[model samples]
Target chain A: MTRKWLRWMPAVAVPAVIAAAALAGSLPASAGDPLPAKTPAEVLALVAQHSAPSLSGTLEQTSRIGLPELPQAGPSSGSGGAASVLELLSGPHTTRVFLDGPSNVRVQVLDRFAERNAVRSGDQVWLYSSKDNTAMHLTLPADAGHTKDFGHYKHRDTGMHGVMPTPEELAGRLIAAADPTTEVAVHPEVNVAGRAAYNLVITPRTEGTLIGSVAVAVDGESGLPLSVELKARGQEEPAFKLAFTSLSLEAPDASLFAFSPPPGATVKEIEVPAHGTGHWGKGHWPKHGTESGVVPDAEDPAPVAPDAVPPDAVEPDAVAPDYRDPNGALARPTVTGTGWESVVEFPASPASAEADAMLSNDPLLQQAAVAVPGGRLFSTAVVNVLFTDDGRVFAGSVPAERLLTAAAAR
Target chain B: MPSREVPDREVPNRALPIREVAGTDGAADVGTAEPPSDRSSSGWPLLASELAVLFRRRRTWAMMLALAAVPVLMAIAVRASSAVPPGRGPAFLDRITQNGLFVGVTAMLVCVPLFLPLTVGVVAGDTIAGEAGLGTLRYLLVAPAGRVRLLLVKYAGAAGFCIVAPLVVALAGAGIGAALFPVGPVTLLSGDVITPEEAVVRLVLVAAYLTVSLLGLSAVGLFLSTLTDVPVGAMAATIVISVVSQVLGELPQLEWLHPWLFSHYWFGFADLLRQPIAWDAFGDNALLQAGYIAVFGALAYGRFVTKDILS
Candidate 1:
């Protein structure tokens, strides 16, 4: 009888062994050999001096805005097929990023059975969506030069951009625009993507703002920003984060950057009429309007809007500061305050019938938006967008009530 | 689900083969309990007979035909509809009208969560319990089929069903889709268009990936079958586990447990359709399935070897 009972021992033992093996594997690889530490200012200087230009890696991005969960469709096509950037409103996404100096960049947003790619080589940018098998091509104007001014390319992707921001880009933007009212600190040691790094923490001093503090994981060796995490005020967890799960400092293949639309893909050519660069999305993406032909003062896409505002608005200038232009080339995006508490209000532009219908029909948008006295208010962990009844938009990385007050004042 | 009623009838039909194969089981070995090696010594004959019995059933055929009907019904529905569905249905569903090939992919996606698993549960749960329930287990053991060989044979029969279910869905989908809609160059998930030949290859890979995905479930069902004399209970339990695993997989709060769940990668077969097929999910799924088979296969062995044949 004892021997018969012993027969069942294998059942218990096997599963217990397998579970132990899995638990061992999931333990984060020991933060091996911590790198020498640096102060927050030293890390900032390191980022300024960092020059590892050519690299390839995969990025994992997750958001915890407390929105409704994303559909279980499959890394979904980020800001592609649906032409609704809000489609990526929640959930984790995996994007493969490749770069080779200033001339070539490729970002592949992986969906379950589909992919969306944004490839930039020389003066050409090709955005391809495998779900619909469609490709959009845009040629940069001569003045948008191929020199190391990659910041121009970042500006060009103001609205409805297919790719998520690289950790380097987000970290740089946050650090570059850090004002006197912000404090910078550093955690001496940290590990990310299996590499030792410095955690540069930046906190805003002002109150009445939604943002708490932002942390950038700066690679100790190459000074690359391996990850960027943002916490909303009063939240322990990161409200938004984009980080590299793996990294390779070597240059990606040149062939990766040389993208041509697959043979059967429907190709649409976008002609940039005048402003060497303007926002790509007006409404529902790739609007075939060569009609915004008013040649402005050729402004180098100014750093007007505070980078933290994650407005769900489709318009880019809707979040940019509104400074009344004397020449009336383009109405200034109205920013109400300075620094962290700033609010940007949009000039009254009539919403198209199609956009109104689209917004009304999207279940995700409906769930996030609530009725206010004047209009509808939409919110995320750190940003708010109040769609005023009179065809105006008020947005900032502030609470919903602040945005409503700004809308009423306007 | 009326398929549950048919496996009981299978036991009676299988009685004839048992009599012919183990003709000398005269109940003399009932006391000392040495299995009478009255049949052939070779394991192949027994394995072949086990599989033959499983496939010969009306329930297996009914389940397969029902699975095949999914794509047929979908293709016909899409064909009968108006010119443009215009953003209707799930991910690959909208593309079905443009490319007939998408029908198989879409149908597979819809069925993976429910239909494939239900059939797998039935076949696997029916393996041992159905024999014990019909008073035929003593006769088979009296044929002196070693307990290990019988267990392996039962598992093989279950695994065989897993392969057929998904293939039936994919092949039927392709045939119906090609007949109804225009078939042309297949555009992959990476936007790369491949020739029809390559598309067929991708479909086969997807089918194979799905087959691997279900293998773990079959083992689980086989283990559950050993615990009870009622085949229906085992079948229900197996299906419940598959559904529960998927439900747990969907919850974000239990994300730490998701990777360990067998169903976590069930839909990952779609990776086979991508231009440069992502092989990571395939390898991981096979490893996870192997783990399940190892753990549950041993449990079934332990339980079945010790149980006294009373039915």
Candidate 2:
């Protein structure tokens, strides 16, 4: 019996070893491997290096800014109501972005059944929405005056505050926000868009911000941001997420940077107002002037005929005076706070008895409007609109109390 | 072992039937009982029979009636109201007073979320399991209707309900809306106005789009139906899944799951309001629905073909 058992031991041991080898082969090699670690400073440097001028990819963006239920009628005007911010942020939107150098860029925002493309080639930008079959041609203002001043003015006046940030933009802002007030660290490696990525977590040290931390996933090889996530204070899950579902390092085709109105499309020409010289306490405001500021692009041979102007075309110089009431009361807007927490206040309008009576009579409007100390407050996720009893309208990305304070200020 | 047991059980039944027939004239009795050229063997006949049986049911008529009544009630309510509430409902709701045809579009919006999905779920869930519960499925299978063919017939019946339910709502809404409100050129979401003829075409497209949206839920209900013999259980499960998905889709925290959820693109029909017709979401919705159909349809096929028809 001992001899027989010894003879079978070799066979049993060999099969056992083979089974162990097979199981090992089936297991992932990187299962227990540690992620590559780097310092916060190194991560920041990598982010700066990868902020390339030319690149293109498909971006998937989603936002949940904790918005209240909006009234069904939707925003009232072209500028959109307060709920428009919620609408823009709450849903999933796919944007095909091409930045073949910053000056020539195209962003195609795709909706379920519609497509809207904003293509900027050289000085001309064409916005075409396939749904309405409408094409808007905007002639960008000429690169006149100080580029830096104009850049600053554009950055402040673009009304991009509180809007959901793209991956690259959010990455850049996170880097800029890095200071003594922020605790920066490099997180473990994770997969994003099918590529290995390292997350750079930026946590605010300040107590006032609603944001707890922002995590940016940077591609391991290319160093470009693949995704950005933001978590509000006391929340386990990120409140906002924007990421590239797929990306290509190769430069997008040059043809995609150009736009032409399709056949039967109603094309409308818009003249972008130039940055005027008027400065109200360091902030530039558009001055009411007759200067066309329409620097004809040398590439395009078609001259803009004066008669071709639409009846409602906003004269560039006539922008400033429009802010004034019939009584010549100028409602100059002023900015307060800095960076992400900035707020803009528009001068209060003198309340009219007729407007007061109308507000009192409309029960639906009364129900919709939130009563404050002096007026009503309409709030959404990222923006708040305050309508004072004295007829002043102040809108910003701040809370109701902040807007009220701005309204009450002398 | 289970496969072997299935044949063992079936063999005894087959022998008993033959023995009983053998006591009489074996050949004639066998031939009459199992006809070589049964009409049910054909696909079209089976589908027609299945659809007829489905429509004959009281529940089928009741569901369709409930679906059709929604638009009528909505039109009456809107017309009865003294003031046209702005920014209160869907984009088309605000414009219903301008053109009554908008009532049809608004009705589609109201139904697509919950009501239409619930109706589709009930019909699809009942399709296969209902037969099984009544002990008729075994007879149908033995009629040599072919398992695949019978499944397809059931699906077709469910698909029929899906298409008809929305059409009823849209058509009734349009007729009532046109009667109560002014019908004229329609202004699309793009703010560009189009002729009344074009608007009618759009309304048709809206109805078609809504029907396609239900394909995912129908597939889910069909798959669930295959999992159990209880029709009511399957129906409830299908509806519960839809509501759960919608709820999950609304959560900001689960933003990553939105695209994969069936309910995510249900609202894509709104893109039809655009002038040139937004094809991105339209195409995406179709592709997503097709994906769900392929997945769940395969699951149902895989399970049903080999399933022991103990009932």
Candidate 3:
């Protein structure tokens, strides 16, 4: 009997596992349906079973910018003193930075790519580069400088605050634009880099956009992105490649952090004293911009009529404001989109006193990072923006003052 | 002579004339007519006998040897090569060789695109035309063999050679590939990786599919061969047709129509390597290839049976 059972076991066991898998795989999927209520430890163990024995080795990948034939090995931009190609590639440049955390913001330029790169702190700013060896001046907006108000890792329940929607959030937005009933699953996981990451997979329940299903990989550790890949509806080919390099978790060195006036460099610091010259502290009007002179919507709140306010008041009185007024002032601005927000640390240093004086002229960042805090030298500010479905910018503002202050405190 | 008992045992000695049979006479009358020279069994038997005649010519043996030897050479070369990635060599070589949807399809791809199909055309091209060149076609026709059967025997020989040639090439390549590469399992597109044994099973199936693809092309060549008097012309024409189809198939702008083209099915064997085996599309490809074979076969038979082989 035992021998017969052993023979039958081989035949029976093979089919049993397959049967189980088939049944399990075909089970109706319910929203947020947990995978059989197994412990997290058990899930990890099951996943580990299938993973191959990984060889531990660091992979170093370098991609050179393929430039057309050059007669010389030096920089050909004509504005620069002769510099190697590597120097040119690594120099001050604006790169698209995507921070995916509580309130996401796409920083068009994180740091200036130039001979001298400068990072702003509240009361001080740091400037370092090959071009400037001497004391250099830092600049900031006069009234609306960097503030640490918006850079914390606000949890899901925290009210949304950001200029632009994150890529993951955008997935649903885009799908919704094409067809409603599209469902998206967002979860946190560890990526290949061993960093905590937020993974979002969007599937359309009804019709889908040109993009059928998309998975966005956001780094939960740094609240920064490692890569982005777009998967088209029926395409087998990869549509695009987006990646980041030279990621640093630690702040840069302090000595190199501060901006200095380069030797023989003429320093001119323009300091515009903070003054409440307009209805608002800054030149920004809810209706009209300073430069473009574009008019805002009729419903947009405008500066109160001078006669409607009491003599002592600097602004409008909301009490008994015309009820039928189409542009009646609202108490606070509406928060329109989803975003990620997280505080990250960077080195805090200041350029020459002249540079700090120069930064004071900027109207939006006058009070940010006035003094470094003990625990963190950083400040925070909210970034707000609206974008089209395809990630094209409609309107946005990244408060450099807030970002710079936050970096200093951290 | 005693006619009563002698006739029961002994046959009539006098010969009958065949002309008298036409006049309602018996075989005795018909037998006397001159022997019908037209009824002689000279056509196919004569051609079959000429199998030795082919051997006498160095080129025939060379052609056969070349066909047989090329596969061996390819097998040896593939085995000798170390350029392939470790563990993937066999599957890759097998893919390049026996797989009809893959290897066979690729052969059609490479051949049809440039000059490979032309070689198939050469054999087909020479079938009737070569015989005409040797003047043996006329001689064979004079014999009792019908024009249809004569064309058929030639077609069979040509197609048989075509099938055998590719089979040898594929098997040799597979053998070399197996020896050189680590053949334990293969990763398929369906994401289900299989062991070497499973891969081998799939490989065989794929090879059979490739054979089907080849059969269609042979039919096409045979049909083309019947159209021209010059063997070279027929071979070239067939080759040109293959080339044209391949070129036409590559026009991505005409994607919908490409699937209907016969050459479109050339890549069907590649489907075998796909895990979970996408049989629906592969099956459709096979059916399409079968249709081509049938259509071409019918056309060849129709033309050979009815048309004159005067040239």
Candidate 4:
């Protein structure tokens, strides 16, 4: 029996030892290697270098925008409302983004069972949905120049046009917002998607800012950002995280840069109204006559009897200076806080009273919003919007009190 | 010495001549007997015969009936429910009220994860092992149906089940759905609406896609069936593996393993509802199922051919 057992010993022992060694070898050796430390400025410079002119990768974004649960819009509710905006910002979304130079970019957002692709190549941009087999082609204005700085163009275009912000565009905006007032530091090196990265932490120096700090992990070699995390003030955890779960610096296949509506898809062509001399274009204010257009300017306020106003109600314009044009061209929004805590204030129109009333009546909106002293405040995890009785709308990343102060200040 | 004495005792007149003739003619007899069996049994006839035997089983009809009942029950439940809030459930569940065909889609979605796979497992797992368990495998082999050809026939029978199972549910759901609810233009998940004719075409496509998706599981079951003589054990093992794959697919940390899991793209049919019909995931599913078929089909063939038919 002993001899028989010995005969099989080598067979068993050899494989066992080999497997043990293989398991040991697979363990990460990150502990032994000390990362080289660098200053914030150096890291920022590397990040600048990393933002390549053309690149593509898979992006994963998770927004814990602490949005209060809103009532579902019943079939009666019309399309393109504030509820949709909240829906866009309050979920975990995954997308594949490809950028070729500044003029050609494609973003494909994946749904559970569907896909929405926005492809911008040259002067034409196509929005395609696989679910409905519908395609919308938007021809950019001739003057929307083909600049190499696509990030800047995308920000200016998408922000004004109300297009959903792509993760790559959002990352660019966050990085561009960095200024001297931001306290920057380098964190220990970490691995992102199997690649070594250097974390650049940016903390706002100002008070009343809701964001604690923003951390961006830059690929050590490519200088490209691998991930960006935002933590709200007083919170130990990040409220929002956008990261490239997988990235490739390689230029994507050329065919992806083109878009042709597949057969059977309903194709609609959109003519982007030319920009007016005023800073505000058709993109900012609702284009009248357009299908599903924004609520027509409230020049004629909804039939709310003047008696509806209480004697104690404070006039918002009296407290806050009117910064908007009577013709409805909005003054460029003013930014107060820097970096992650920045508050962008757009002077609201008194004409918007009609629009406000319509929104206030929306059961879904009413449920999502909380009554404030002078207005209604809609709060989400990462953003807060204050709609004042005087028709001024103040939105920021800060808390409601911060927005209230901004709204009340002269 | 006893063997020699026995031959000598029987050696009388015929022993020497018979022994000399047997030695010379043995090779010729063997050659003549082999060709007739080889030439007579063609693969198609054998396949037809095997399919007949398989379909004649009461269990096959029972499985088909059970699958058919799923859609009927789903339609009844959805019709009875007061309201299904939009965007609350799987893609088409909310639309069941508007279009009865959506009930079929909802039924498919509900069954694909567990019921469909389990039914497939039962059929596929019984293919080879069940025959062996009943002590019929040896007799079949003796009929000299080529081993590889016999394995292929078994696989084809299981593949046939995979196709028919989904069709049964779809037809039942469509029938019950038409009776219980409204039928009109189908609204796709992409928010695009298509004509009823287009919707029917899509439903057919969905059924076909589902059948292809099930190919992976069928192959896995067939492979497991080749490994064991006990049909129940093979069925249980196949179901367990599918459940394990599904659980692993759900784990975020094991996301890297998702693409390799046979169940990973089972839901890719959802893409077919999109306006342009997103084909990336759909194509990937087809290719992945084909890969699984190739690998496990080969494995089943490799093992079954050399297996001892003790039963």
Better of 1 and 2 by lDDT: 1
User: What's candidate 1's DockQ score?
Assistant: 0.29
**B1-311 in candidate 3: lDDT tens per residue?**
11121122222222212111111211111112223343333334534544434345475555545544444554556546644321232223333322222232223223323333444566666766777665445444433344545655666666555555455445543454555444344444222346656765765665555555555566678777767677777777777777677677766456566765767766545455442343544676667666666666666655554444443
Query: Which parts of model 4 have CA positions greater than 4 angstroms off?
Result: A1-37, A51-53, A68-84, A146-148, A155-168, A234-237, A273-347, A350-359, A406-410, B1-118, B121-265, B269-311
Pairs in steric clash, model 2: A72-B87, A72-B88, A73-B87, A73-B88, A74-B87, A112-B281, A113-B278, A114-B278, A131-B275, A289-A317
**Highest-DockQ candidate:** 1
Q: For each candidate, give its TM-score against the true structure.
A: 0.80, 0.54, 0.37, 0.58
Q: Per-candidate interface C-alpha RMSD?
A: 4.0, 14.5, 26.1, 11.3
Residues A1-410, candidate 2: write the lDDT tens digits: 45435434543554465457657855534424444677888777786777456767677776555544443221122212223323454555676666665566666665443455666677666666544356777665565223432222222222121222357655654566666656888887766766778888877665544556778998877778889887766777666678887676677778666566754456877544564332211111111111211111111101111101111122323223323333344445455654334454555443223233333454533454578898876554434556677765665544567777777884
Clashing pairs in model 4? A50-A223, A65-A381, A66-A381, A130-B274, A130-B275, A131-B274, A131-B275, A132-B275, A133-B275, A133-B276
DockQ of each: 0.29, 0.06, 0.01, 0.10
Off by over 4 Å in 3: A1-410, B1-82, B85-116, B178-201
**What lDDT does the true structure give each of the candidates?**
0.70, 0.61, 0.37, 0.64
What alpha-carbon RMSD in Å does predicted model 4 have with respect to the real structure?
12.4
When sorted by DockQ, best at the front, the candidate numbers are 1, 4, 2, 3
Give the top-scoring candidate (lDDT): 1
In model 3 chain A, the worst 10-residue window by lDDT is A302-311
Residue B24's lDDT in candidate 1: 38
Error of 3 at A337 (Å): 12
TM-score preference between candidates 2 and 4, better one: 4
For model 2, chain A alone compared with the true chain A gives a TM-score of 0.62
